[model samples]
Target: MDDQNNFGAQSTLSMPAESIPVESIPIESIPVESMPFESMFIKSIPIDLTSTPATNWDNQSQLILSFESMPIESIPVDLTCAPTTISDEGVKLQFDPKVIEKKYIEERDKRLRDDGIDQYVRLDQERQSDLYAGSPSPRDPIKKEVDFLIMGGGWGGLLIAVRLIQMGITNIKIVEKAGDFGGVWYWNRYPGAACDTESYIYMPLLEEMGYIPVEKYAKSPELRKHARAIGTKFGLYDKALFQTELLALDWDEESKRWAGTTNRNDNIRAKFVATASGPLHNAKVPRIPGLETFKGHSFHTNRWDYAYTGGDTLGNLDKISDKRIGIIGTGATSVQAIPHLAAGAKHLYVFQRTPSSVDVRNNQPTDPKWVDSLTPGWQKRRMENFNTIVTGGHADEDLVGDNWTDIIRKLSVLGGKNQSTASADNAAARQLADFQKMDEIRARIDNTVLDPATAEKLKPWYNQFCKRPCFHDTYLPAFNNPNVTLVDTDGQGVEKITEEGIVAGGKTYELDCIIYATGFEFVVNHTNKSSLTIRGREGLELSEKWKSGASTLHGLHSRGFPNLFIVSLMQSGLTPNLTHMLDEQAIHIAYIASYCVENGIEAVEATAEAENKWVQTVVELARLQQEFTKQCTPGYYNNEGKVSDVVLRNSWYGLGSPAFIELLRKWRKEGKLDGLAYETAH
Candidate 1:
């Protein structure tokens, strides 16, 4: 499943040309010193656009238009006409690029906190148990031994289990903290909760399970049901331990096994262990002063209080009709839930820090005819097509045509093949595309929102991918409602929470309930996020080993962690469609596990040299990615704008998801398992 903590809502809004003014500037008249850094390269270059096509710019022409020898701050032109593609209507400067860059930096600065990731408090077992009282049917703990023990029941764990089952390895057990198998889907049951990515690609094993999503983007209920279906179809229910929090995992050198302990007082021993604990497993609330003193009813979006809200996922929140509600954080979660809150609350106050780039999410029902026309391996092909396009590669056709692919295609126009790198020309091109998309988004806010002041506050000034992009038809319109108010904090966020309500900008707004849409603790240490104590060979803690940064070969096997597979984004391929990446990791893990079992290999681990080489390669490739992240607004994506060495070390494989997958595929095809060392069983 995609990060439930990061999913946003969507709806369609017509593009308004009047929202953003476009002006044609003469090249000779404009001062070279006044140009923004991105426009420096084309300073004196003459452009004859009379022969250019009206709609799409020719590929050859794009290649010739390079921003190679320009300073980043000198470019002043807006070259893009739309969010998706460039037009041949001649170059027009919609806004001053240098001024916009300054505005972005100013907006980002106010949001930066000294505490960084520590500004939010991580939820623990006590909090989760209290929130989910009477969950998992309250089962007694037990001691058991198995061939494989998986640490999560999300898509990552489920996919691994399914692949292992297909490989004829059945002695497996999955431990999930939630009541069911859906992981994020199980927890985030708020009104309007749904996957942001298209369900066909985001939901894994759809073809294998012979299931078709009811909607192009499936809702939380359906996603959860699909998770259960996978468990039932593969007989995973019998092997799953629900509502169990794994406490610690220790490598048993003498027995060649992994000893595990859980919060429920259960002991488990397994020959192999795969930690599929998801990145967004823990929910967090901002560390606002006087938060504990608030007498008003409150809850995080991840742990939605349906009893108080009186609504299911469909958003009939009738219970709050007479109550004054306040929601903090205008992020992806707030974008999805605000409309529902506005509909039910007598008065709604949306407190904003940094605004999310709200775009058009024209969701539709899945076509039965399209589903029927699919031949064998159609899903794989469709998935690959989406991955290819999003990662700046050429595909025969755009299969999953959506906002994601469209924006990437626009960037690829100037970025060439490697989008991450900061080669002068590529960076300039990518920035131009990014600025264009964000302008369209801002224009969307201006058109959809009735109040000009509110629209201005709602406009996001950062790059498109700085934070997860939000799509919603009604989110902007919701602000137009007389009963709803937008309280933008000028990026300083809420000042404090009082007994009556929230205090922002030195003003107190009394609220009956406050909903925290602050999101999860991403970009932290894996052990801290998952709440797992993992000790490998010679008692080397995973946290200590990765204190500086991650040390793994292909993000799966670390040097000291024998028979321990880690399923996460760290040092692995990162993509918007997380399940696709998870499936790739699962397939690779299953192959190695099956091979080891069959070959009588007692233990396997990445060699020290191999791990070092992989880490070095990741660092070298990450230079471009780091530069891009540095320019983004403060958020989980850029480690709250700190970008420390640890963040750089823990960065995803810099070569993009498609390249990372191919690397693994080639490694497997060789049948050598080149980087791994194995100890054969006696």
Candidate 2:
């Protein structure tokens, strides 16, 4: 991007010639699609004239000499040279980077913002489920008070609850909207749902449980079971409020405690409130036309219709074998589930807007011998090693030698400095390595798929990091089956949904079922991440206060929201593996909460000055990552190409979680938490 302050006198629409390097061309100077293409192309397609035979070239030279003696009309116009590798940078931005203008964003504020999210959903009721046999237990009829109250029962809730107990902050309770404890894993029970990352590192409390997974990537059921185990281990299940939904949350300054009202018409008060409604639980259905009018059975992948599908995650979907199925969206969820659907459905239609970058996933069962040969604290050590390498930091060994660590392993071999503290040159080297990796994955598609046209459409043109990379050994080969059809929409999504089928790319595919593979909506709108209005001391809603942007001293405690805590990835060192980040945040928040408890402190909040400085530092730190994410195809990671200034600034800790953890440990070591306001009894 050209420096906005350094624009020249030329019209803004003018673009430099193709000979100029793309990096040197400022984004504001021109849009990618409008720029004149290289003369190396013959008509609309590209070819290699240089590869012509030597005898043919001699004849062509003689013809050219003859043309010199003839009129200009006799000369031929050559439109192509030898085929050349196209650099990714040469690919123009699909549109001006600023596709969504400022005015439109302002107009869309209420619809897209955090505060307005609750308006779209049933704010007072929890998501309905028939899985649990029991109904909500009889309420206590009166408001109850506790030392700590945590919202959510999944990864964020359970993990933080464990940490709080570990720190001796007992007398806590957890309010969950779900019928059970596994947040995302509980809801997303699709046939192929499993952890993409290795189970050892992805699962928390592994050491505590002394449990080893049956496979490298644990299935969804195992993950949910683990969450239940952790909750029971920490005695959180007994203190949990199931089928409870928070309607409103507000601070009680007079009593110096926070009060919350639930959908069951019960009131709960706590000296401190911590929200950990992990962002991934809320499923999003695209507002395609006639979605509600579909006569056929349809369900979001998050809420899989197991009764109708006649299968669990193990995938003996015999019930749906005769049914023709159509699925919209081919992201991670779709990638994993498609193989199962293709096997069962009489005919399957995969409607893809943008093809996910699929790579090889050679998943294998865990070796019992490997588990038997273990050591103490081996899980943590393995996690650190994996974290170190993947975050552009070096590791001594690659324990989980899979696709996640593949690029970094190559980086370490080529240049030792490609780790987290990489120099600018090393960063560029990593990028080139990334491009090469994506190219290999693309090549794999060509070699694997029998049809050239299918292979070409499957080949992702953008950089690998733009979207979440998917890996599966069976996915590509499954497409070779006659029953599976790939409906590539070229970029424009499905035109719309009709009662009987989906209309995509000007074609309709009729089906007996339509499964939504669209994943969870990320926490882009600050107010609506969790559909509850949290009011602080000044009676300002969390969303309203964060209208400018979210600011937290440690991504734990926010200013003005005294005694309120939030557990999430924002303003914290955001690791690609979300569980690692949650663990780090749980530890950090627990430490602070414990500190307040041991000292007999009543309230804890960050000073405004500290918050401003932290937010500024966070914004600066996230600049590069923001650029990287923004370039990716529309996904939850980048707000589906509708990124706003606040979205980037509020979302993540830019550098890496390892650095953030170290910083936090050092801060605790100093024995004083500066820039935090502590309320003490005089």
Best model per lDDT? 1
TM-score of each: 0.88, 0.80
Q: Against the true structure, candidate 2 has what lDDT?
A: 0.64
Off by over 4 Å in 2: 1-142, 411-429
Q: What would the per-residue lDDT of candidate 2 be over residues 1-682, giving only the tens digit for each residue?
A: 0000000000001111222221112222212111111100001111112332323222221111121232322212111323223333222111221122232233223223232222123212233353543576676644789888999988888888888888888889899987889887776778888887888888888888878888888888888899898887888888888878887889998888999998888689998888888766466666666777878998777667878888788787888878999998888888888889998889999887667778777778989899988899998888776766565454557887877677545533322231222123332333333444555777788899898888877776555555566777777887898898888877666678888889997778888999987655564555576658899988978888777778888787788889888876667665546777677778877888888878888888998887876777666544434544444455555565555677666766543555566667767766677778888855
**Best by the TM-score measure:** 1
Residue 248, candidate 2: Cα error in Å is 1.9
Give residue 11's error in model 1 in angstroms: 26
